[model samples]
Target: MKKILRVFAALAPLLLAACAPTQLVRNKGDAAALAQQAAREQKLANANHWVLEGKLGVSNGQDAGSGGFTWTQDGNHYEFVFRTPITGKSYRLTGSPDGAELDGADGGPQRGPDAEALMRRALHWEVPLDELRAWVLGLRAQGADAELSFGNDRLPSMLQQDGWTVTYPLWDTTRQPPLPAKVFAEKPPYKVKLAIQSWTMQ
Candidate 1:
């Protein structure tokens, strides 16, 4: 008995340390709940018409593109339009909830992933895009989950809820029928910044 007690005493510090609490690692359940809450908030914020404007910056390089956008959601269909620095072309794309190809600037069909996909591919950074658009439009994602948090900015900020830290900068205007300003996802590995300026509801 004395021998056993001595052995336990010698190991107590290691046992206590193994059970230490940590705040950095986010729980999956909690993260999902946060996403659901954010979806609810976003859907409520969605309207027929809203305006937005902001810049997108990258880490490895620098990119600033700002333009006006219009999204019309009818049933499960969505129509989007935008004008930016990357393309002088004003693209109007309409597609269904599922993977459907629409008018694309490259003379190709805009499909799964969509413009954001191309942007992510170009920037070489992985981001929660589907969630981003939903969040930007203030709607819930059709398939993927999301994360939302309030940030201190000239507008509102929503940090990632996916256990990954992707800080999104936003500005919520106090318009009867609330509206979202620019929603940005600033990533690391060269400092990536993607912004959706001016989102107007048709």
Candidate 2:
């Protein structure tokens, strides 16, 4: 009986340790920040009609290009124009829910079912225009899961979605609801950087 009691006493601590609940470490501020972000997103969701003027830089680990751009969005329709300073050439991409068209490429004009495919086929640029429209505004794109890290300002410091990592280094707080001033997105060899000069929201 003494030997059995010694063995049982030794196993008691192990059994209690195994039955103990696990402790979870969490940051209390994270929940508040996420709620703020959600509210911001809701406020900006209806801000679809706007014009953004900026400088765009794109690279594919080999070829690179930088140009001034004007993006005008009206609900489901959008028009994006790019002007190259060095080449003095201009390209315009316009589309709606129907289809997309890319004008002023190497060839005459290219038409496709979507902007992403049209851009890739016409300009050899691998940019996700559908997702970018939302990301440019510091909001996560629809139809995809995203992971966001908040900065000290409670704004998003980094956002990862659709296989791309986007970082907002600056924000225009002067606006009613702050907007991203500089949006940089990268996925491996492909990188797209935008330095927004001005924003006109309607």
Candidate 3:
């Protein structure tokens, strides 16, 4: 009993340390510096291509859904595959700036002029797919005025743009260009949440 008590006493400190909250060392900065960082990162992302796998959730006043997705973006071309648990069906959307295509579980392929419009009409999900590419990269989409709030790490903690508010709560620091572990966006009747599991950059 004495030996067991001593072992437990020795482990207490280790256990406490393990349970302690992680201390984040921030990149302290002013607004200008934070904005500069955002711009730089955005430029970097746009110049390169990436593939991300994650879970995505969306909700509107009338409709709501969640799914797992694989997104691949190369220059101006992008391909997205979403698997929804609700219908146990997978949808594939591929597009460039010029046009978009969606293939449903029924194997019927639909093409359109705009991805978001097409999705709204076909899936009843109002998501700005094009703007999301920039949002996912921690940048504001073009053609919109953005208001940004920075976290301790000098990265965006919250952003308001184009009628949507996006929040970044988790980050992955292992990659050359660290990415968000979770991203949530809300715009009135529409909301989007993305929980990124992996990232591959080229």
* Best TM-score among the predictions, by candidate number: 2
Model 1: per-residue lDDT, tens digit, 1-202?
Answer: 1232232233333332332223222233355555554554665654434334444322333322233456556645656554433334454555554644445344355466454554444323244544555556544455546554443222224445344344433334554334454444444433323354455455
Clashing pairs in 3: none
Model 3 alpha-carbon drift over 4 Å, by segment: 1-39, 42-45, 105-107
Each candidate's lDDT (Cα)?
0.43, 0.79, 0.72
Q: What 10-residue stretch in candidate 1 is worst by lDDT?
A: 1-10
Tens digit of per-residue lDDT, candidate 2, span 90-165: 8899999999999887658889888988987776677889999999999999998988887777888788898998
Candidate 1 TM-score, true structure as reference: 0.47
**Which candidate order results from sorting by lDDT in descending order?**
2, 3, 1
Best model per lDDT: 2
Candidate 3 all-Cα RMSD: 12.5
Q: For candidate 2, which ten residues in a row score worst on lDDT?
A: 19-28
**Candidate 3 C-alpha lDDT tens digits along 1-202:** 1232232333333332332324333334587757666665755655449899987766555545566799999889999998755445678999988999999724389899899988887776779876788878777788889887767777667778888887877777675455667777888877777878888878
lDDT of 3: 0.72
The positional error of residue 202 in candidate 2, measured at the CA in angstroms, is 0.5
Clashes of each: 25, 0, 0
